[model samples]
Target: MIPIRDTAPCHSRPVVTWSLIVVCTVIFIVMQWLPYEVSYRLIHLYGMVPLRYSNPDWALAQGLPFDGYLSFLTNLFLHGNWLHLITNMWFLWIFADNVEDRMGRVRFLIFYILCGLFATYLQWYFDRTLEIPVVGASGALAGVLGAYFFLYPMARVILLPIPFIPFIFNVPAIAFLGIWVIIQLHNATTSVVFKGVSVDVAWWAHLGGFIAGILLYRYFIKPQAEE
Candidate 1:
């Protein structure tokens, strides 16, 4: 289901959330104008490639900086295409505000980066030999979705379950996020079954990020903080 928005309200401005959307958007626009070769190089250099880090000698042979660990954070700002960028930013727009409000801007930003890092590393563990570059904010955004599932379980979400039908369905946040988890789990298990096949999406990253968020959010959230 395509989540349009959530009924939960943010008591404070979601500065970190908005900043993330804008930065990712600007980076994506700049990437679109680069030459194909340059763009491919940038995607590989900046995106988290499991094989690149797993085998330092191979990475050096490929002219990649073997010691560079910055891709763990950089990959969150890079996306493959318009759909990828749009879907991730849209999910952030819908759900991140309340999370930011709960955790505060600085904490929210830290939480996001940590989740993304954790996710990338987890993906690396499962596909250490795969040469594909894993890019996009989906993993980090999955973290936010997981936090939202815990933070606002009863909150109402407006969804477009069927786009062409123009139907709007309102459901509990838990239900929507639960469906998301199921989808990720199913895809991750399927990916495990076909181990040799290279897949475009990082299903394991999604599951890892979601699990990390659920487990780590409480530590970030400050219940007694001022509004």
Candidate 2:
């Protein structure tokens, strides 16, 4: 289901969220203009490759860039294609503002980066042998979804469950995000148990980020008077 928007209102301007969206969009445009080979190499260098960090020597032998731990954060700014970028940015735009409003600008930024890092590492843990470069802001955005789930469990969400039919409906935040997490869990389990299944999405990363956001959000939440 595609989320159209949410009912939760934010009193504070989401500076960090807007800035992140602009930066990701600009980076995506720059990536599209770069030569194919350069773009490919850039993604490898910046995008998180589980094997790159898992087996540093092997990665170096294969001529893959091993830039310490930078990719964990850098990968959040990279996207494989236009569709990938758009989907992530769309989710971020919808949910992140409310999260940033509650956490404040600097704290939200820090929370985002930390959640992305946690998500990347969890992905690496699942399949350290995989050499494919993992890119996109979904993991971090998953964190925002997590925060939203907690902060606005009753907030109404507009969803388009049937794309072609254009049937939209309102659902509670808890039900919406609950279903999302369940789908991720099911896919993650299926991928691990069935080796032949070729699931491209980072289900584990999404799950981990969501959980992290739930656990860490209370620490960053502003008091009632402050809000």
Candidate 3:
């Protein structure tokens, strides 16, 4: 399943959400100017790694400032490529306005950052010895989707069947998000059984953010009055 846009209307302009997307885009542009080795080193320094938690001092010595606490915030902004940055920012644009509309700007920003941090740790806990850097806004954006599910389960999502396919249709948020969660769970489960590790994507982070969004739904989103 894919999501094109949501049918719900926003009461106010989603300034923070848009601002975040712009900032990420600008940062991506700047990153592109840098040498690949430099960019890789920068991502490695700031991105989350499960091994960092085992010994804070060693992690800090490796350029993880403030004993790795800062990575939780910084990692969300880093992405591997144009596709990574674009897809994440695209989802944020599509789903975040309604969530921000429900929580208000300041609270929504806090909720988003916290969700990203918590999701990063959740991924780390599942694989404590991995050395690969966890970057991108996918996990954080998953939280946005999760929150959207709770606040607007009945809202319609216009989704394109595939990137190349012109066919599009609308589906309830719950069904779309439910399928998303199921796919991630399947990948996570299979990764554990076969590879004994998460190689590419941090599926555990998606699980973490999904659960966090579900748990915090009551506090984070307020439903609009019925028409």
**Which pairs clash in model 3?**
none
TM-score, every prediction: 0.96, 0.96, 0.90
What local lDDT does model 3 show for residue 195?
Answer: 68
Per lDDT, the best of the predicted structures is 1
Report the Cα RMSD per candidate.
1.2, 1.3, 2.7
lDDT of 3 by residue, 167-195 (tens): 99999888988899998888877877886
In model 1, where do residues sit more than 4 Å from their true spots? none
Local lDDT at 199 for model 3: 69
* CA deviation > 4 Å runs, candidate 3: 55-66, 222-227
Off by over 4 Å in 2: none
Q: Kindly list the per-residue Cα lDDT of model 1 for residues 96-177, writing each as its tens digit.
A: 9999999998899999988998888888888888787899898889899989999999999998988788989899999989
Can you give the lDDT of residue 54 in candidate 3? 67
Ranking by TM-score: 1, 2, 3
- Better structure of 1 and 2 per lDDT: 1
